[model samples]
Target: MLTSIEVAGTAQVPATDVGFLLYKHPDRVQQFATSQGGATVFFPAASPELCRVVLHVDGVGAKVDRAEGMGRYVNVVPFAASSRLVVVLGKVFGDALAGRCATRPELVDNRWPMTLTVPSVPTGGRCSPAELFEPLGWTVQTSAQPLEPPQWGDSEFVTISLSGVHTVRDALRHLSVCLPVLAGAKHYFVDDAEVDKLQRLGDGWLDTHPRRDDIAAGYVKHVRSLTDEAVMRLAGDVTTAQPADDANAVPERRASLARHRREWVVESLARAGARSVLDAGCGEGRLLAELVTALPGAQIAGVDVAPAMVDRARERLQRWRGTSVWQSSLMYTDPRCRGFDAVVLMEVIEHIEFDRLPTAMSSVFDEMAPRTVVITTPNHDHNEAYGLAGQWRHPDHRFEFTRADFAQWCASVAEEYRYRVTIDGVGEPVEGLGAPTQCAVFTRDDSSPQLNSSEGGRR
Candidate 1:
């Protein structure tokens, strides 16, 4: 059970300056008690290149256990980043939230590159993370967390990553208000005082936000009177509010899909005891990043046909000195691609022409055969969820496969290559249609045909 927020700093502002802004000593660990639980604040990493301060709410499990009724037995407060966590944050960082930095007053209004990571925040239906945070000036990235035992399917809770250039005060205030709204509930009763608090936290930005009404309503627990009053007050105080550019809010669901794909692949690889991995069509190396972190001490590498993608991958994996990314196509066999414990092709097969898929897939199953192979692609059957009943997800996608179609193809490949394949769905499962993304995990069968340098596929 965990709930935490990380504040990252850049070289321009330096990590030390963040200490002055927050009025907390970087080296000291501070603890505070809240109505929900105890919160501990400390720096996990502090340097010129990057600085991160983590505020973690602990003792939540014990507190939940002591609560009365069904709340004690069935509540997400212990694990989900709920309104309780936001309230604790406000209490713990009161001075910082008010934009008061006694030691460095000038830094109070300065904007700097900052990123905040909230590991688990419940985003109920009715509003997506992009709709809520984007209007308030933060770029949002979210990964939906699956339910425990997994059979329950994906939960409403998501790990939210927000990045933007803004004063530390603005960022703190944004989270102070938005995180709770995203959580979609308040732990306490809502009243006029709550409206005042919401107005104060959302002072400058809420008036201009496209989802301001939703935010106001959600913040005050959906009490009609309070929501109306809060919205009116927000409308009146518009002096400092800047118009948000709604045109550029990135569609975040695709990012979530990519994350789900990566997590599935990594888990499948780890389950198969894969110590080394190669990402066959590793685009910009998003999967590579996950592999390095998830499978530490294991050899990791990625290959893409595009030179630009390879360059980006190289830069992205620079932090991991041992990992590598190179330019190579999955349709072709390269000696460098063989002999890894696992190889992954994530959201890639769809981009290849249908006729060339066999060649590309053969290169993976026959030539660069690994102990495990994980493949993920968009399920055409789930396209209706995206309002694209008969359309491709991406313009460049040569073809998309329905669940049955994907399964049949995987079965053929597994039989042809002499491997065992298990198919599963990724992302939230749609009723009757299954998950938005389909996955096929292939394990090499030792008793079957051996790996060889086949000449049929491009090299």
Candidate 2:
């Protein structure tokens, strides 16, 4: 099986710089491996008058295992416009999708007139092309293909053509999010990470999309819990309070509180005499950037599981000296993250699954074992203070911890690792409720023989 996509440039905005945008030269044929098989990306034509790019994906052959004897197995893996294509697109055109065009800086921010075509995309009888793209400002044309004669009725696949003016980044973002929804099933398993991917890639446009529910359902394969959470997040109803008389006041207050949280983290690190810091789960490097300004002499490094977030963080800290950003998960032990004097998990723990917390804690405490470790998570008890009772601050959060819950977890981990723990609050404190965010700081006990042996052995 094969699936492919073609993109053509318009006369006014010729696609001459398409190669630069994709970070692949027109003269080269790029091949990437996929779960099913391989994908090849090449430019069919390249010139000022016209430019075209094609992505061709091949499916792998199916083989039966000898262990399962005498049983018939069917390989129903989807190959057309599936998550495989999304993965290939990310590999071949990630720079373009991320809106990075160093060679053609002038075109980075401009919307180019172009035409996009996908020859064989499975719609799964969910929706029409017009219904999905028209509302997103694209002019759509679709043609359905028929299934095999006599054996089956109409096929679920369709050829779609979209013409519009859009930034390459926006166009690719739309395709990456919508293509899997159209396929109706993923090539890989769905998990909370899938929800985070959707939220991150669909950050700007998905919130207001007219077919958001349909899109969310299709993307997550209709897993009720995942779909509901995605939809709630995109709708901005997860933790937002009802409109009050002073709408501006609420937003202003929230911004101030966020600033306070970051400031507290930085001040605490400085007080601990931390000269080197690792910002674990540093999404977009917001706190990392602030740390750069606040502690000009301190060495800074950031790590994130998402490549896109790491890329953004790198861009944000490009000018800062002695600062590094890379893509890596905190769930496993990483040699590069082992020697920092301090590690900050600011506003990150709540997003991790409960089952995975132990691995993350072990990696930080037993493996890296920074002198000081700081973590902050949402205060569940404080939600009601903002008129959001029994609601989480973000949909991607696997579990939010109240003050007691957070403190208990921290104390247990500290005890297991020979460290002393202290807890504090961030943001405004309510009478009976607590602050919107809670912080836990863990310090290695200097008297511990394990700490002394580890340091002495290194010397």
Q: What is the C-alpha lDDT of each candidate?
A: 0.76, 0.75
- TM-score, candidate number 1: 0.49
Give the CA lDDT, 0 to 100, for residue 49 in model 2: 58
Deviation from native of the Cα of residue 452 in model 1, angstroms: 98
Clashing pairs in 1: none
Residue-wise C-alpha lDDT for candidate 2, range 1-107, written one tens digit per residue: 34333345566556667677777777889887765467777877887756777877675642322221234354334346657678777877788777788878777
Worst 10 residues of 1 by lDDT: 450-459
Report how far residue 24 has shifted in candidate 1, in Å: 1.8
Clash pairs, candidate 2, are: none
Considering every candidate listed, which one attains the maximal TM-score? 2
Off by over 4 Å in 2: 1-13, 61-78, 148-153, 239-459
RMSD of each: 21.3, 10.8
